[model samples]
Target: MITDRHYEIIVYGATPGGIGAAVAAARRGRRTLLLEPSPYIGGMMTSGLGRTDIDWLDASGAIYREFAHRVEAHYTAQYGTASPEAEACNRGMFFEPSVARAILEDMLAAESRLTLVRRSELLSAEAVDGRLTAIAIETEAGEGEWQGRSALSADVFIDGTYEGDLAAMAGVPYEVGRESRDEWNEEYAGVLYMNFGPSKEVLPGSTGEGDDRIQAYNYRLCLTDVPENRVAPGKPASYNREEYASLSVDAAEGRVRSIRDVLNILPVPGGKTDTNNHHYCMCSSDLPEENGTYLEGGREERQRVRDRHRHYYQGLLWFLQHDESLPEAFREDAQRWGYAADEFADTDNFPPQLYVREGRRILGEYRFTENDARLAPGLGRSPIHADSVAVGAYAIDSHATRKREAAGRNVALEGFLGLGWLTEVYQIPYGVMVPLGVDGLLVPVAVSATHMGLGTIRMEPCWMQLGYAAGVAADLAIAGGAAPRDIPIDNLQDELLAADQLIGFYRDIDASGLMGKAIQYFGAKGAFRSYEARPDEPLTVERASALLALARLLPGGSRFPALPAAGAVLPAGADMGPRLPREEPSPAAYWQRHPLLTQGLAGRWLQAAGRALSAGTAGAAGGSVSASAAARASSPAAAWLRTDSAAAAEGGPSASGGAGEAAPAVSVGEWCALLYGLLLEARRAGSSGSGGR
Candidate 1:
């Protein structure tokens, strides 16, 4: 029976961002309705792309880290950490697709405030006076489309679907294709391809102004070479020998060698590989002129497109492995690989979700353009943002927008664009998550960004981060009885900071452990007033000194005394503790920039602070700190720091010679823990030695 339902928060789609939004909102005491079209929850992670594409770990925020830790625990519990399975899982960096799905399912089931409905799709949405009021959903009843439909009213809504269906139904403006270069002043925008390159030659319509050309979509296949756990590729229902005519020609001419050569086979847990298309159209899986149509079409149409892709790709796989028309060597090499036995058993070893590379992007209030992604002349970093809700470090990565043939050469266009590695992490503004002139709705997955800009922000981590932020924003708005856009940004930042969300990288604190409070404390004292440290980027001497001064300053007191009058430097051949590994190299060149905080200097300063505090001259511990303060700086939270410090003190790189390693830069979190931990330890020692002094 279809019935009208009311929810405080309605999250459409079970994409990672949607799951994140739903979990966050429910955890915050709001009634959340999480709807998904499929039976499974995880999108691609549960489908086949098990290896996470996370680059900037610090930028992923608290929830993501929490999820990662849980995955690690799962492995440790089941496989004893040292087992090959656990090692292959790599602590959530790689895992089985089913494992990813199971985790998401557990998360959903554990949340009491979240109501999840699988096999339900959002049909339409209603918005009045710029605020979305309610939405309609079509549920599956047995095996028929006539399943009763239902209406849902919610205070806030999130469109986390890759297709952006809810946002479209709500009448929010969106773009479906690449923008013209002049439209957003993005150099990589518009139709970009080489006129004479082997992959993308001067084909008709090869390089033209922007059109409704969406990037190619593919299923992230999980395959294994192990005969026991592998299923041989068989002929699809729509198999055609004609499809291999062109490919066979390329193979006979030596342009194509073994099928494995044109496939991206990334190793995952249990010896399985996440396979996808490589160069020269081996598994590009892109269908031109159909993607745009599917974006605008209904769920049924989208399903058809997805099915067509599966059939075509499956047929291509069968042809490569079975067809005798191809070279015997290539065919035999292809025979070694087959579908993973443990993945997607429900779909006959095929992935459930289609890897929709590009889709409807919300025309957000503040559109992120390529200019926001531009590298600083020689530096590989982009400009920073004050209103950053999340950070993304991945370069602009886009697959092929279109494929064609020109001058008897197969050509793919506008496929790959990258800045390789960034000099600094880029900030994604909060405004990008809000659709322009739309209220009570946050489009985290299909966020507002130019085609070129979306290249970096479209990753799963960025989406999940944005979705988590959206959930917080929704909760804040509900509590304040105000629109999401009307909430004071300062208050938002405060709330985000309280939850350990990465709004900005102040004092080298990326919201890891109890670092936020420490960073915020030093930030409040103007120690890091002018500095914005990059993710994992080392701190300079001046920056480190500034932070240390703040830590040493007595609360309620004004002035900071100068550094302990130039401590004696250790001369060559001096006995420096045990030998350790080389120091890690800092991101920037030391001579070109300021002096870095070496491990030796950091240890010496820590030892000096401890000595000074024990002598009763350093500073006072004030009235009281937060009850959770100790836990925040507890050893477990700061274990990595201690390990590094121990290594450094033991004639490590800072003491001995370790060339081209990372210079020991004290993180804001580490410095805070060190300062507090040392003071506490020294106080204990002082009290033990004193006889009622």
Candidate 2:
């Protein structure tokens, strides 16, 4: 039997990006429907990704910020501080998967307009003249048809599934596998061969001749150290380690270990550790043979892959926990963390979905390439319109495509490449989210754009921001009676900027209003403020902490205080002294010449301030100015003093100011003096800022 329901918007996947998109759509007062093939809401976060590989937290938008806040709230309520390690292990922001699931579900429930259907699969979709007309879904109860899935028959449909299944089914053209350099004229697009092992031994089956070979995929496993909560490795019904026997043997022989071996273990406060599961094309458990086939495979074949992953992860666990071949210290450390009691109970201890790093990326009208990333020095202008949605920072990290052993050694290309550590953050245009010819459908994840582009945009926060943008575009399409791709760039830009989405890093700012609040928050906390905030620039560890401190979100108060007056200048022979090349310009000098960098700095400072204010400082008065003026004012020296004065003046509770007024000017020295006064005022007012003291 088939039943029918109507909704203004339909979001598939239930991944973090899906949840964000659904919430965004619902919040816009759309009659939204969120369908999850799995039982839980958070696809990765709540599955087993306790340790996050967040690339650009500085550029993460409100949707992601809300998610982070919930995580902080969970810890604060339980441990009185955001640092979980303070209560137990040295855990930072890691959380139990179940807790993340609960938070996402709770957030969904709070929105009365959103409908959540769990264990529901999108069987098929019907479109008319480029617009999605209806979708047929299968659930436990029975099959059902959803009509007007978006406003006016889904004015815009967002594909949030990690696998890009919906987009593929909808007849959208998408690309799978890496593109050869010849195709995109990109330096980093083709197959790369690198030596990852300690020695320079060349192993056969390790080198690749082409880029057709795809990277391996794996299930992110959640492990724990507690014996009572520990679950032993279980063999999959279709257990067959023979296929992987060679790799296992090599790993045992210390020739090749799973990426897990190099995992950067993030310790939780309570003695637990969050292990990151990274994948490379040639590494252990990457399952290269399983690429592209996941969506097309029959249920049995799919289950087989799942079984293989289970066995692989199980074998991995056994090796980590009890393998005598491993060093004693390694074995002991591996046994410290096990599955959390409250998470993924049904799977015995595994996430439901395998982390699909890349899927069928939609072949949208405009394909972003490395050229777009490195935009030629003097291209007339970018085909990428001004409507940008998200920012990306991760390197172009493509894994090996084949396995080989040669010259009595096994070698693979598994390390990161492209735009090394010093690469600037890249802006993702709204066009990447819009599909060509497909009127209603928009892909926020695993859709459209080049393979190299995916390297940076694959992070969770970036995905969430893209999802948010998709939702807003859907709303605009519904209200204005236009297709997603046809939603004028000007209108899209206005809405995105209004919503606080950082687009282009250069064009938007309400700096005085928000930047001041940020300065005040961090200044009062005695935290080191980055002399300048540039959105397009990659965030260094130092700057990240500074921003966190400014937002009052850092676990502890300022880690670095203002340098003593006498020691402010670089010491003679100091390696840390300014190391800019003689012919090259400093960041300050570059900002002066590049309006984009200037705008980026203004927007970032304002964004930092906005976060600080929203975290709970009262408003500071200031009038609006053109982004140009804000950009000009963000020069290093001026920016520092401006931020310093603002931070000093409103460092306390009950700060308020109306638009356009200068408020009150406090000199840098006077600002420092006011810090003590601000502390007293905050204490008296019982403000949250007092918590830092």
Candidate 3:
């Protein structure tokens, strides 16, 4: 029997990114459906990966930040605000798998427009004229529309699954594994062996040649020491003592002192820790070369790989706990920990999800490379994306893709790289989400990126940001009756900014504020002197006027509409000329005019504009004029109104300030911020057409 259902957006996978996409779409008032192959949600965050991969909180966009806030609130609500549970919540980034799952479930339940189908699998999909019109799904459980074969039709389909299953089924081209170093001129491309790196050292036999090998996959188990909530590891049917003979040696040699030495066990709330492979450990959960075909394989092959991982991990745990070959002290430490009884209660107390680090990445509009995330040459930041919808600061590192000789060197772990090196704040362009040839589809999870590029983009925080963007973009597409790729970037960005999502990075300021937004807005347009937007520096009122004038020209653009005669939509990678109003310079033209953001000359346009803003808002007695002191500047014209409105929003100068009393010292940052805020408010006032205010 077949069933039919219609929704504005359909997202598959129920991973963190899937949940993010579904929830954002629904919250934006679009009817949405989220399908999970498993009966669970929140993927790793709710499974075994309780630790969120985020360091700088500002880089985290709105959705992840909201999840973090709610997770903390959950603990505080259950156990008082000052309780140990609340304190251990680590601002919601630290939580048990169960807590994470429950929190996400609650979040999904609160969204009335979203319908989540559990244990659903994608059977096939249909497309016409390069547009996906519908997809077929089969749910093994539940009842009625929730069970059996069904056809789902939507305006837009977002593939949020870790494996890019939806996009693949829709016939979007994809790449798996590493690319040649020369392919994208990426330094970390292909087989890698890091000896030690203050700088990256390529070992002998290390080749930048392309290969199909990808980083290893493993389950991040949630283990607890609580007597009442502990399920001891047992011997798996596939356990072979010969496979773990090396672990015994490590324990005797002090390389493996306890379970902690082999597995990275991080403390979360509720007396449990999320455990995963330790990169430099003697032995780890990661099994290299075992997962090579999992990406392109059928359901059975994929499940076989997952089962292999389960047996390998379970056997290792049992070996650590019960094997007499290791010292009693080491065994005792391993014995203290077991799968948390309250977590993953189904499926034999084991995490049901396998953390697929790298999957089938769509060969989409733009293939992001390491260069996209690295600080370019002398610049302090990464490449500034014109259509930036999200920001990421995580290091571009991956786990072992190929293990070394069984006895050789753990340091010889091919493809193993560390964090905190060669990564700066980078912006992810919307093009990554737009798959080539597929109009109604967006692949936010398995995005278009080289293996090295996926190193950072693969993080849950970054994927969630992309997922959230795709959600908003999908709704915008529906509203305009346009394809996902044709959604106007300015509209998407405006929505992101309103929700306090980080489209651009600021070191000393908050993007949600007008000052931060203004600077980031222009920065995205390549208006900053360099890539940096140092918004806190003082500026003259003379400079501020020019920038406010400049801000006026940066307006929303029309979607690169299809040509009427040809009647063909621009393919995903087509160069959409000039992402700015006709009045503004192209990014190249602007780049040549300004170059890098220099610190000298009022700062040089954050130098030219910063100088201009500082001169206009807070200049020297002869040159600059703050809001209170601007007698010459204080005519009740639009300039005064603009500055006044900015000042009011910033809580700096009073609304009733008379002409030229005594202008306070205004920073160039403040002036830009104030002007930007006024500009934003005026823009949002929507097609009133800047009534001269």
Best candidate according to lDDT: 3
For model 3, the stretches where C-alpha displacement exceeds 4 angstroms are: 195-202, 406-408, 529-532, 540-553, 556-666, 674-693
lDDT of 1 by residue, 1-693 (tens): 455689999999989889888988999999999988877787887888877777646556756666666777788788787888787776666778887888888888999999988888777788999899998888886525326688889999999898788898899999888878778766567776643233333344434477777777888899999999999877888887776667787777776788765577788877898887774553344555456668887768888999888987888788888878788988899989999988888899999998887788999878987776566454334555545677665666667765554422454445444444432456677888889878999998998887778887877777877888888888988987988776645445545656776654554443554455445433433344333534255555666666655545423111222432222234346675563324523333432343555555555454434334434443422211221234335632344433223443542233223442354455545655555444334332332221110
Report the Cα lDDT for candidate 2.
0.55
TM per prediction: 0.74, 0.67, 0.83
lDDT value, residue 506 of candidate 2: 24
Q: What clash count does candidate 2 reach?
A: 45
Candidate 3 on 1-693: residue-level lDDT in tens?
475688889999899899989999999999999999888888888878888887766678689989889888999999989999999888887888888888889989999999999999999999999999999988896645577888889989999999999999999999988898999999777877775346555676667788888999999998999999899988999898877778788777777788888888888889998898986674688988899879888889999999999999998898888889988888898899998888887788899999999999998888899999887776677887888989987888888877656422544578777646778888899998899988899999999999999989998878888899889999989997888787667667778877878888877766666667667766776656464566656454445445655655555111111111110113245565644445555544543433322122111112222223332444433332331222223221223322222242232221122231233344656656544443444344342122120
Whole-model Cα lDDT per candidate? Answer: 0.67, 0.55, 0.75
lDDT of 2 at 463: 84
Poorest lDDT segment (10 consecutive residues) of candidate 3: 558-567
> Of models 2 and 3, which has the larger lDDT?
3
Question: How accurate locally is residue 631 in candidate 2, as Cα lDDT from 0 to 100?
Answer: 30
